[model samples]
Target: MNQHPAARLTWYAVLLVLALVFSFPLYWMAVNSLQPLFTGMTWFPVRPTLENFRLAFTLQPYWTFFRNSCILALISVGIPIFTSFFSAFAFARLKAKLKGVLFMVILSTMMIPPTVTQIPQLVLFKQYGLLGTYWPWIIGGLGGSPFIIFLYRQFFMNVPKELDEAARIDGCSTFAIIWRIYMPISIPVVATAAIMSFNTSWGGDYLAPFMFLQERQYPLSTQLMQVGYILPSSPNVDLFQVKQAALLIFVLPILIVFLFGQRFLISGIMTGAIKS
Candidate 1:
């Protein structure tokens, strides 16, 4: 079953090349953020400074943007995860006449582009006087993500039905079964949902915040796009360089989450895939 040594070497060589290609932008960003402002691009900087980091905060209300981002991310991730867990459990464990049909309908929603709904949603929010508040984002997440529910349902269905029967015989309530048994074993799935949701909420949906919220309420994702970082003392500094610095900080949390939870994310997906 083993491949020839030359073939294995070639495969690894290809992977190494691809890895470098994919990672080069991150490397370039780091290099650019530290390099002297307005200098020509180089593989490495000769006189890097921490001044860009300082400028990133001073030029704007970066901390306020950061706090807003965190608040929205938490709301965006939490409500859906909580709601999805139970909804997934119903699809996975309960028997109903139209369960499959219902699940398919929910799955179909995933194919609907968010862009198609934006105008209608914006009007709805405005009619409700929800614009300029966090309610637009909050209400959007209450339905939970179909994809996360699908992930949870797949993982839940893979568990033997006998376990549920056993718990029932021991007088475990339905809620108890989920809390004491399913949740403990589904750590990987939880981590997977969390990382996915966090990324989407934290940086993915700029249009929602931009359209619905005030300028002061903008998150890091939206605020980073503002074109007023030029300092009077250092008007020569490239705006792109300042953004690079802010972007590095902007991306750091997502990077850290994935780096640590990638193992769980892979495990959750693979486990779900094995059964369905």
Candidate 2:
């Protein structure tokens, strides 16, 4: 049943090429980050240096941005996960009127463009005096995404109903049953959701933070725009290199989280997909 040697070698060659092609952007980021002060767009650096990275921190309050991102990410991820778990448990197990219709409506919202409600949400938050503060971001975290809820719902459905019965026999509440039994066995899905939430709430998110937070409260992502501090006194500096350095720094934490949780993430998605 094994393929011929030449065919297998050709397959591997194709895979290698695809991998390199997909990785080119990240490779470019690394190359640019380590590039010397004056290099422009390049496939390879003639004299790679650490100065770009050195300046990435000096040009901005990179650590403060990092700290704010961590806080926002944690708050955003935590609230959604907590809410989604209970909501999913209810949908998957507990009987309710119009449950399927409600679930469908939730899923349907994903088809609508988020921008449609952006102004309305902005006006509502402003009325509450949350404009130009982190409160709006924190408040927005309360509404769990439908996709995450669906993932947990699928995973919850796969758990044995007998567990719930046994928990009930022991006088445990439905919430207790979920926390004690289902969640313990759902580590993969939990990790997958956590990683997804963290990544979504982290870098590359300009809209929500930009609307709610001032420049002083900006995360590393927004701070990247004010990259003018890299060489304020010098007009002839290659800003492309400095911006690339900021981009790499902004991406590193999520990259680390993904690498660490990749196994769990894949397994969880696969399990949820199959179960649903």
Candidate 3:
């Protein structure tokens, strides 16, 4: 009906406004990144320049930061993919004693704030002399992510058990049933886990690395925090512009990844929701 079209238009207008509102910080960051630091910034830059980008690289060892983050994210994601998948498969397909109790304990952990365990984990790492190395990040990833395990378990539970039975009859082992039968079809959920895990690992908060890594090994997120208080040692440059440029550069990888992964994210969440 004509009325339906008008109503839909009104909803679209409302949603667009909400979207713009939420996106304002990113818009501001982009605007600031292009503005000259000495211009004192406006809603939009009167004179846009790539000078800030040039300064951003000169001001810090940005290449090192990018590399470190990539290493951390890849390791973090890789460990979870295989470990969480098998853990989920076990929880979903295998019969075991006290399964419900063990699972409840794991789920209970999500209720406890991460801050509460941060100190204990830090102390434990320090005791093992892992404080200043990538071991902490690697070890933490290998420890198993309960959230991802839960996601996998949920999605795995949604699959038909008949698949397992059929695979077994065809001389497949437990691992084969998972790798051959379940995994091939679990693309959506797996993608969701990988994307979400990478995002969590790549979050702008550099505090985790800040606490563990030495100054030279600090990531861009940590370096950017220090940038605010200490402008580049050079006296002749614009400070604000460099900070904005760094913000833009620092966020680009995650932004690019999310853009490419968004379709998978949507489909994966939809597929997983069929069970949960």
Candidate 4:
């Protein structure tokens, strides 16, 4: 069943258009970040400079925010991945009577909107005297997240029970079985959860760290908002270029993560699609 040349050409055209549509914003950001401030708005930058990037770091503690964001993302993703791996393995392999019910309760949490819990969470953190600290974000991640657990459980379910039985017969404890057998096979799903968790904690703008931390302790996203978007302009400041440069910095880490882990990310996504 060979396709006609005209039909293939049309499909290629459609894909090319979609690619351009998705890529234009990123392209524009890169271009504008290099442009001179207060210049006329254009699709392409006329004259470019690195001054905006220089000014961005000079105006604020950009490296501090970057390090803080990396720490937060690492903690947030690392906690969920290891915890969810074990929880998912237990739920998928160990046939306990209450397993179904417990899994249902976990799934139920996903139905509730996070916004509804924000005030209560804020008060709870405040009561614990953990406000203006990293504790809130760290604690949230340390608890195995409902969504990541679900993802891992689904993937684990697709694994053959025979492997678990074999490992058990070989005198492997539950943790050993999970570590020596399932974990190796579960790399795709783990990568998926890691990428998702990292992005969620890295890019999230509300609650968690935001409500718990003050100005100096703010995450990269919040700091970007404050210094890049909300701050009042001084008479001598070139606000436009500064803001553009800040936006560029904000997106850089995410782009790097995606570029580096794209293969693993794709494998993770496809692993879930496999049927038992």
Candidate 5:
């Protein structure tokens, strides 16, 4: 059937507006980061300079924070992807009598407001002496995240049973099946989980590192809050430029990753939404 020209034009117009709405902030940030310190707020920076970017690296131990953020984000994203994949595969393919009940119990955790458990989690981490280190964040990611597992399980279940049966007939073990066949076909869901996990860890401000670490060990999110909000009392403070630069440093990595992975991210999200 032929498409309606007016409807297509309307859809394109709507998308263009939506794109501008989403992109405006990023555009402003990029523009602002290049502006002179005392230029004030303007639509366009009259004198663009690399001074903000330069000051960002020079003023704070920004590189250290960047490295720490990368480590934290990697562990937080990677652990969930690995653990959730196997757990999801089990839920999708295994035939244990307790499977349904156990899955329900796992899913139930998602219903509980995360805030309700924050204090308890902090207390537990402190008691175990895991605070002030990466352990807290790492442990959180190591668990089979309920939402990710649910998404993966749905995708895995959609794969033909014949694939598993054929692999088993050839004497392939569960591990072999997962590694050799199922995983190969599940790239989109994997990408989805990775993107979600990475974004969550990269942007998360309230938990994980917050309760578990001190100022010295704070990740980019916490550090950004510190540097951005805390203005110097002294007149000598290059407060405006320094903070702008710091914020730019903190945001650049995530922005770069998103730009590079956007296509895969979109594909993954769409494909993962398809129920088996």
Candidate 6:
């Protein structure tokens, strides 16, 4: 497994370049967000100010949008962890007819583009009278994520079966085994799924919330569009700086989540890959 010192140095250099390239947009946004209104494009701000952020809040109910986003993210995080863990446990531990077939059917859903189902889902939610509320997003999360279930099942499958057997011998029920044994050891996958769900609900989604929720109920992702262009009170405001400030605030949570949970996310993903 030994490599030349020069090879290692070259690999490191390539990675550093790629990292900077990938992060450039974020760097640009942060730099622009601090710049004063009407400031032209510059690599670095000549004189930074918080006026853009102030305008972003003044033009929109920034805190309300943030609250909505947090509510959705929390719901998205909790529901999937509850549903996917148990669903994955059943697939991983139990014996059932058509088990493999059922699991594959669930996994197949992942391949279907969300756009294909949006119209039908929209109609369904509208019929249920959930269109203007958070219920649409909440109900959507009730159906546990296929990817997370697969990840959990893979990680569970890798666990020694002897643990389950021993637990059963001690009068542990199926639920008890899952709760007491597997759940404790599944922290990495749990954190991974939670953060993924949070990110998707918090920022990765725009169309669904925009379509389903009321204007006041719109989360930051969808509201950002409104903030960017439709400054009702300040039609003459510098929109570029306002948008940059809004975007920076919007993206900060996702950035922080990734920075902290990336280790668990990688571990969870790799653990699943080892077996399947």
The C-alpha TM-scores of every prediction are 0.94, 0.92, 0.93, 0.91, 0.91, 0.95
Model 3 lDDT per residue over 1-276, tens place: 557988989989999999999889888989988987677766887788998899788767778887877877888788878788888888888999999899899888889976687789889999999987889877777757899888888888888888888888999998788778888898878888898888877774467788788877776677678544135466555488678888888888778888988998899887777763
Worst 10 residues of 3 by lDDT: 227-236
For candidate 4, what is the lDDT?
0.80
* lDDT: worst 10-residue window of model 4: 229-238
Task: Please give the clash total of every predicted structure, in order.
Answer: 0, 0, 0, 0, 0, 0
Best by TM-score: 6
**What pairs collide in candidate 2?**
none
Candidate 5 residue lDDT tens string, 181-224: 98888887788778777777887754656677877777788777
Candidate 3 whole-model C-alpha lDDT, 0 to 1: 0.80
What is the Cα-based TM-score of model 6? 0.95
- lDDT against the true structure, per candidate, is 0.89, 0.82, 0.80, 0.80, 0.79, 0.87
Please tell me which model should have the higher TM-score, number 2 or number 6.
6
Q: Which residue pairs overlap in candidate 6's backbone?
A: none
Candidate 2, residue 145: CA error in Å?
Answer: 1.5
Q: How far is 116's C-alpha from truth in model 6 (Å)?
A: 1.4
lDDT of 5 at 207: 60
- Which candidate has the highest lDDT of all? 1
Q: Candidate 6 residues 56-148, lDDT tens each?
A: 888778999899898888887888889889899989989999999999999999999988899999999888888888786667778799998
> CA shift at 228, candidate 4, in angstroms?
2.0
- Cα error, residue 115 of model 3, in Å, equals 2.1
Better of 5 and 6 by TM-score: 6
Which sections of candidate 6 miss by over 4 Å?
A: 227-238
The candidate, 3 or 5, that scores higher on TM-score is 3
lDDT of 1 by residue, 74-148 (tens): 999999998899999999998889999999999999999988998998899899899899997777778889999
RMSD (Cα, Å) of model 3: 2.3
